[model samples]
Target chain A: MAVNELGDHLRQGHPLPCGRLVEDVFDDLDRGRIDDHGRTCVHCATARRSLTTLMEATRALVDDPAEPPPNLLDRIMQAVRAEGRRGEALPLVPIDDTGAAVVPDLGPVDISRQAVAAVVRYAADTVDGVRARSCRVTVDDADVGALRIEMTLSLRYGAGPANELVETVRARIGSALHGQVGVRAGAVDLEIVDVWPEEGP
Target chain B: MTTPDLDHIGGHPGDGPGDDRLVTQIRVAEVAAAAARSTPGVAHLQQGLWGLVQQLGAEAWTRVTGRPRPDTAGTEVAVRVDPVTGAVTVTVDVMLVVDGRRPAAVVAGDVQRRIGGAVYAAFGVAPGRVSVHITDVAVPG
Candidate 1:
């Protein structure tokens, strides 16, 4: 405790890892001087290197930093925000008594809901004249691994969800889910939002 | 970045005397993250909906700057070390983006297996649960 107090006493605002203020280090760097402590401390060395890099970057930015492409700028910020949005966990195997799909020193596997949805979406996209919009693969409350897939899609402008077409899509989605994920889907509910006219003249 | 929460203070089912080897969350996460990142058909870690947007920009940057993007995988690992015995158990989570060349579900399974295998190989203990999330399906144009 006494040592901490002593270090704090010597510290400037917001001490670095070595109990020395980086601002002091910055000052020393500005004047092209490093004290005995700076010469010996690794943290100070790192800070000095960082300060040097920052100075270089600042000069570079001020000198020539120009406007980033508008589209690219928008995409970067969107990625920053959307990266954290993920779906719920869907167990790949049966959950035991503890509600964890594990075998005490063995295997326990789970995949995200979005992964299953992606499987459904990719499958739906394979159907002719169909564009998949979104999907949700929810676990059945009564069954361990059973899933119900709810999907939305837009049919081609001139096309319709004919009985034959719907059956084909259902079969395709079921096969994709079973083959890709190795789990049987309980129900595949396809809801066509509307007709898309992308291919129209 | 969520991992299984286990009581490490004491009385954990896995905790007992004579277990001396220590394993940390950081180490498991490192190993698991490496394995997941190396798997094929992973454009990068998950960034939901049209990850193609971000991938396009990143690819352009790499093309211009000649520096590959660093640290793409975000593996969440939680470790519980028994205070008394130093025994450890872990749970690892990873989210990835499918590059549209391979099936997402298959890739996800492979990720889970790889992380679980890598952690066990590194620490001689398996993760309690290895959760894989897929945020984007970047179908190639």
Candidate 2:
């Protein structure tokens, strides 16, 4: 029988390993042998083309060489050192466990403070004229998930009025924390440790 | 209905239907957390009040022991998976240092989109819901 005929037979009655076979055909580790049927079948041919495109895109990304910003490593290391100073073993708060019905072997659902800090840092870094030197976050043990945040910032002189800057920071922080983490920031304290001169206009 | 044979699927194990493979909640959370951190307008992730206490304690401990601080701390991630549909939901609380030039809402939306895309790419499962809580924002120098 022709390859197309064989593919038709597989589709009609024989099990042709739908998604799995397509994946195996592309995987480097286990490039499953595809008979002539796979080469001729329309569905498999389309899937193969897609997989090829994906692989090419991935290869291009791997080959790209992008330079990182100055002091990026130093800043990252500083953050790491700060975390070490803070210690490990982040606390995890449990969420609902009703998922046990669907997944018989489900584990506890919990969020960690370390994760929260990372998000805070990212949000703070985006503000203009504000460079986050360090951040300390606290979650209230109360029934309400209230947050107390303290950030040390290096500000640029003449970025904006100090009061305006503070207000903008407060609003952005409140919105980001609530939107991303589903937590409320009860209070945010910003300390300006240093002011740097601005660059060219 | 005929069950799909999962063993033939490539990539991670539990990614297929009816395969004894399992994706841990922590792993999913990490993916979400990484996505959030990568979003623009974010400064750093903060550990809440308890985190503050821990830092103070660490300071005291460092003063006494004179040992170097460890870099083990980062953002936290929490994941919830639906048993029926296998959908995942993620909630993240973050502190941002936004550009004084951009609107806060715009940055927040970007973070949300990035997190959703990252989760889908990593797990082949689109996040059912992604919630972001902004705790603080600052102007970057």
Candidate 3:
């Protein structure tokens, strides 16, 4: 019964979904120490999936340390120097107003499908153990436009790390697209294109 | 010294209007190529010879060394030295003449060991630090 409560929290995306019972259950499963309850209980299945996804995302955050594009330094330095000269200290320069001047209030130009795709690509690359070989985003013009993104990943072979890579990529990409791009990516379909050696030959 | 104009001083006089980034890229690329060529037996190293050489080692000169004869069973080792890291890795591009029967993986491993050993012997550097990139495989007919 206590395990069921934990399962409910996990399914509902509650923080601290794993309780003492769930922790013990996973420990037992890991060591092949669980005898019967784990197999029969629905709680164990839900808990495992939730915990695994959470752990995978956390692992990706830890493993992803690849430096950003080197040219970023040049761009940043240029922007900083440009800002220093334009001492107005305003974030954006307001255009000079005249009697006939018309201003348009752009309420976040409906985040384009392309923007979401870019965020997805960035997030997918950041996921540890997953290398994004290619990505494509398609927008179906329905009554309401729907965005679908497909990503091809090169799984790193020769480790259990690759097994977790899929979930990490999905979670990170989905979150990044939603949060940064402000677009609801309906589905993030993934294809494991090729398994490259963990250490390249 | 007289104060020079900001625009002129900021601009590198060494860089002419005709001077393309390609020239700098090419020079860096050639340093990479030279590093690879200095190694034992690289059949065909890639265009970014520097990155490959830095990741690999200078084993392309194996044919010149006359170590296992080219006519007989032998492997071509390619080395790329990373100018930034000063690290070198090696990959053996197997040839059909050497019984293309050899596995690229096996040859790659052997090449890796030899390149690492040679780099260590030559530069007094450790091999494990080097990153080896296996860019190509040559299978015999």
DockQ of each two-chain model: 0.12, 0.03, 0.01
Q: Please list the C-alpha lDDT of all candidates, in the order they appear.
A: 0.61, 0.50, 0.40
Per residue, candidate 2 scores C-alpha lDDT tens digits across B31-128 of 66677667665666544333333344444444434543332123334444343554444444433333423333444455556666776676565555
What TM-score does structure 2 among the candidates reach?
Answer: 0.33
lDDT score, candidate 3, position A83:
25
Which of candidates 1 and 2 reaches a greater DockQ? 1
TM-score of every model?
Answer: 0.52, 0.33, 0.26
The candidate 3 chain B region of ten consecutive residues with least summed lDDT is: B94-103
For every model in order, the TM-score on chain A comes to 0.50, 0.47, 0.41
Q: Candidate 1, which CAPRI tier?
A: incorrect
- Tens-digit lDDT track for model 3 on A87-148? 21111111112211112211111222333344577788776666777877666344133356
Model 3 chain A: worst 10 consecutive residues (lDDT sum): A88-97
Q: In candidate 1, which residue ranges exceed 4 Å CA deviation?
A: A1-84, A87-89, A94-115, A131-136, A141-144, A152-161, A191-201, B1-27, B47-72, B99-106, B123-125
Best-to-worst DockQ order: 1, 2, 3
Q: Write the per-residue lDDT of candidate 1 for residues A8-29, one digit (tens) a residue.
A: 5346243443567768888999
Number of the top candidate by DockQ?
Answer: 1
lDDT, candidate 3, at B141: 20
Which should have the higher TM-score, number 1 or number 3?
Answer: 1
